[model samples]
Target: MRNILTLAGKDFRSLATSPMFCLIAALCSVMWSFTFLRSLILFAENTQATFNPGPSPTLQMTVFLTHISQINLLFVFIVPALTMRLLAEEKKLRTYDLLLTAPITATEIALGKFLGAFGVILILVALSFLYPLATYPIAHFSFPPLLAAYLGVILVASTYVAVGVFASSLTQSVVLSVVMGLVFNLFLWFLSQGAESATGLYMTSVLEQISIGDHFMAFIRGSIRLKSIMFLLSCTGLFVFLTQRVVESSRWR
Candidate 1:
């Protein structure tokens, strides 16, 4: 446990020192904030124009959903930047030998790295909360759905991070890892969108059942379906398992 935490801490420090992290974080923060602020202004303007007795729960829900919906796009660009170095940098610097040869197990190493990256992601996600918090006075947002929406953000962001970690494990070059990460994430995200167009009714049902986007919607709508949560967690576990296997294979060679 201590070893895992220590390794995670080391990863956190490494990311903190990297200019790439700074660039990506600054870029995402600015972009998301500006977009959120713009949306708030537009929503407010529209509400005033409508003269529909001001803010209702329905209005709040729609605005919140619309705002959270775009977060996946942010994750698509930033998650790759955040995760490309997890294992790939080890190989690039010839540190894999030292890492694999250490007393720590591959599972521990993977978990530690995931936790480290996730910690940073959580901080960024929290930073994004500023928009909602700032709007609380005006929107009078309901805590239940709002909290659930944040959970959706974390889960969806985590899905991207998991794919990025697996992609990084497959290559020594961070650029290649980032490219692969984007491809893998876009594949899953697009599939969720494409599912509805399946040829047969049964196939469509199956696709909808597995649709990442729909599951995310469930969270945004304040429905904590066990199946949807499990699907995301299973995906995370699968990638983490694959990453550990990658490390284990390289260690034995």
Candidate 2:
């Protein structure tokens, strides 16, 4: 456990110091801030206009969060970029062998790297809460829905990290890892698209259930379904397990 935390801390520090992390974090912050401000202004204006009869503050805030969560789409590219170097760089620098032969087991190494990457993502997610928190004093919206949306975002981010780590384990080239990770993320994100064109009800149901976006929508709508939670968690665990297998294979090579 100590070894895992140590490795996770090292990877977290590594990512925290990188220039790419700074750029991505800044871009996301700016975009989210702008969106929040615009939405809030519009909500206030509509509320004051007698003819408008605008939505409730709670609903308006929920919509604002829904818009903010769209930033997760941007993470499809950002996460792969962030995770590309986790394992690929280790292989490129030829340090993977040293680690493989060290006291750490493959599972520990995979989980540690995952935790490191996840820690960085958590920072970005935390920053997102600032806007809502700042507005809460004036808006006084419900906490449950807001919390649920954040939960959805975290689960989606976890899935992204797991996929990114698995993709990173596949190759020594960081570029290849990014491409593989993006492809995997896109496939998972769009999995439900198949349901749209399907003729059979059962086939459509299966595709929708398998989609990462469908489950995420449930949380954004303020409904915490057990199946959705399990599905997202299952995806996270599945890829982490795949990453462990990939790392273990290095012992033979």
Candidate 3:
């Protein structure tokens, strides 16, 4: 346990000092700020303009979910930047040989790197809360759904980080790692889109079940479904496991 945390801390420091991390973090801050403000303004306008006061706008759209979901799509670009160096750079600099020789297991190394990247992602996701906090007096957001939406974003982002880690493990070139991460993430994200054009119920159901977007909606709407949570956790674990296997193979070779 101590070893894992130590490795995670080391990677986190490495990531924090990198220029790419700064770029991605800055980008996330700018985009999320714009989206949060826009969503809040629109929600306020719609509330004042409407004759019927329906469900709480806070509940209706949930401030974070309103635009965060779209910003979440940017993970395809941002996660790769964050994770491309985890293992790839280690290999490129031949530091991976030293790392493999150290007193650590492959699983520990994989999880540590993942947790490190994920820590940064958590900071990015937390940026979504700024507008909500600034506009709290007027917004009067509901805490329950707001928190639920936050959880959903974290899960989705973690899944992206996991995929990026796996992609990083596949190659030594950071460029190739980024490309692979983007392609893999794009496919998983859009996998649900195929359900619409499917000719058979089985195909449609299968796609819907595996679709990240489909599961993601339930949380954005402020409903926590057990299945959705489990699916995301499973995806995250699967990729981490794959990364560990890759690292293990390299360890033996």
Candidate 4:
């Protein structure tokens, strides 16, 4: 346990000092600020207009949820960059042998790396949450729906990190890891939408069940379903397990 935490801390510190981390963090802060300002500005305009009988459409659940969804798009771009070096760079620098010969098991190494990367992602997500928090006092938004959407955002981000960590384990080239992660992200997006066009009931059902976006949409729409949560978590666990396998295999090479 101590060794795992030590390794995880090292990874977090390594990323913190890297120029790439600064660039990515700056880009994320700028984009999130712009999106939040745009959303709030729209709501302020609505409040300024003459009162309507209908509910405030400007500050509805969709508006806040859209901000979360928009962040997911940004995740698709930066997550690969964030995780591409987890194991790939270690291999490239020939430090993997040191890891392989260490007293800790491959599972520990993989889990530690995963914990570190995911921790960083959660920090970014938490910072972005301030946007929604900014509106609560003025907009009177429901907390439950907002919480559910936040869950969805975290789940989606976790899935991306899982895919990225696995990709990083597959090769020593950071470029290859990024390419693989991007392709996988795009592929999942297409599966979510493309399933609507399928003819066979069983086949379509399978595709939709596995579509990360489809499950994510349920939460975005303020629906809490156990199946969706399980699905996302299961995928995360699967990829982490696969990463462990990769590390184990690399030990012999």
Candidate 5:
């Protein structure tokens, strides 16, 4: 346990010093900020023009949540960029052997790296709180929906980081890791889309269940479902387990 904490701390510090991490973080911040500002401008225009008596609290919440959902798409790219180098860099520099031979187990190494990367992503997401905070004055502003959306984003981000970490373990080149991660994410995204288009009712229902966007949409509307939480957690665990297996397999190489 102590070794794992030390390794996690070291990984966290290493990621902090990485120029790639800084560049990706800056890009994500800028993109999210721009999206948030645009939404605010549009909301201000809508609110100032007329007193639309028909705009209920539910409608307002829907609009705000949808806008937030759009902004979170940026995480799809940013997460892969952030995690692409975690294990790839270690393998590329042949330092993975040293770490593997140390007191730490593969599970500890994988989990530690995952936690460190996830911590960075959580901080980035937290920094975007200004978006919802700024909207409080303009809208009916229920905290439940906002909280749900943030939770959804964190789950999505954690899942992506796990996938990226597993991808990173598969290759020594950071570029390759990023490409692999993107491809995997893209496949899942496309599967969700394809499922939505299926002809059979039962098939579509299953597809909707598996759709990341579908689950996220529910949260955006401030509806916290246990099923969605379970799905996100399951995805996170699956990928993390896969990453551990990948790391362990490398020991025999």
Candidate 6:
């Protein structure tokens, strides 16, 4: 456990020192903030012009929450890029052997890298809080749904990071890892759409259950369902387990 923690700490420091991390973080933060603020301003302007009153608290909260929820699709792409190098870069540089020679098992090394990547993701998600905070002065602003949306975002992003880590473990090229992660995500998206178009009720239900966008839409609308929470957790666990298995298999080579 101590060795895992130390490894996780090292991974965290390496990510912090990397220019790619800073560049992507800055890009996501700025783009999301700009889009969200634009929506807020447009909402306020429309309300004042049409209703002869300022935006209501409920509406403001809803808009902000929706923006936060919807913007996670961006993180879906960005997280893979962040995690793609977690294992691939280590392998490419031959540092993975040194780590493996230490007290840490393959599972610990894989999981520690995942946790460190997740920590970086958590920080990025937290940075989006500025959107909700901007609505603090409004009368109808409630923090509960915003908190829930943030939770949902973190859950989804964590799952993506785990998936990317698994992809990274499959190959020693960061670019391949990124492409695999994106392809996997895109495939799920297509599955969701195809399931929706199927004729049978059972098929449609199954598709909705697996639809990442469908599950996230509930949280975006300030509604939390047990199914969505379970889906994200399941996805995270599945990918993390796969990553450990992949890393373990490589040890016999």
Best by TM-score: 2
lDDT of 5: 0.79
CA lDDT, every model vs. true structure: 0.81, 0.87, 0.84, 0.85, 0.79, 0.80
Query: Which TM-score value belongs to model 4?
Result: 0.93
Candidate 4 ranges with C-alpha deviation above 4 Å: 47-60
| Residue pairs clashing, model 1 | none
Tens-digit lDDT track of model 5 for 141-216: 5587678878888888888889889899999999999999888776666767878679999998888788688887
Q: Which pairs clash inside model 6? A: none
lDDT of 2 by residue, 1-253 (tens): 9988999999999898889899889998898888878878777786667563564455424455556566688778888899999999999999997788899999999999999999999998888878888888887777887788888888899999999999999999999999999999999978899989888999999999998878988888777889988999999999999999999998777
Question: Model 2 — TM-score against the truth?
Answer: 0.94
Question: Weakest 10 consecutive residues, lDDT, candidate 4?
Answer: 56-65
Q: What's the lDDT of the predicted structure labeled candidate 1?
A: 0.81
Ranking by TM-score: 2, 3, 4, 1, 6, 5
Better of 3 and 5 by TM-score: 3
Check candidate 5 and list the clashing pairs: none
- Residue-level error in angstroms, candidate 2, position 31: 1.2
lDDT of 4 by residue, 1-253 (tens): 8877988889888887788888888888898788778877876776788697877564545567668888898999888899999999999999988888889998899889888888888878887888889878876767887788889999989988988999999999999999998988878778866679988998899899999988988897778899999999998899899999999987576
Rank ordering of all candidates by lDDT, starting from the highest: 2, 4, 3, 1, 6, 5
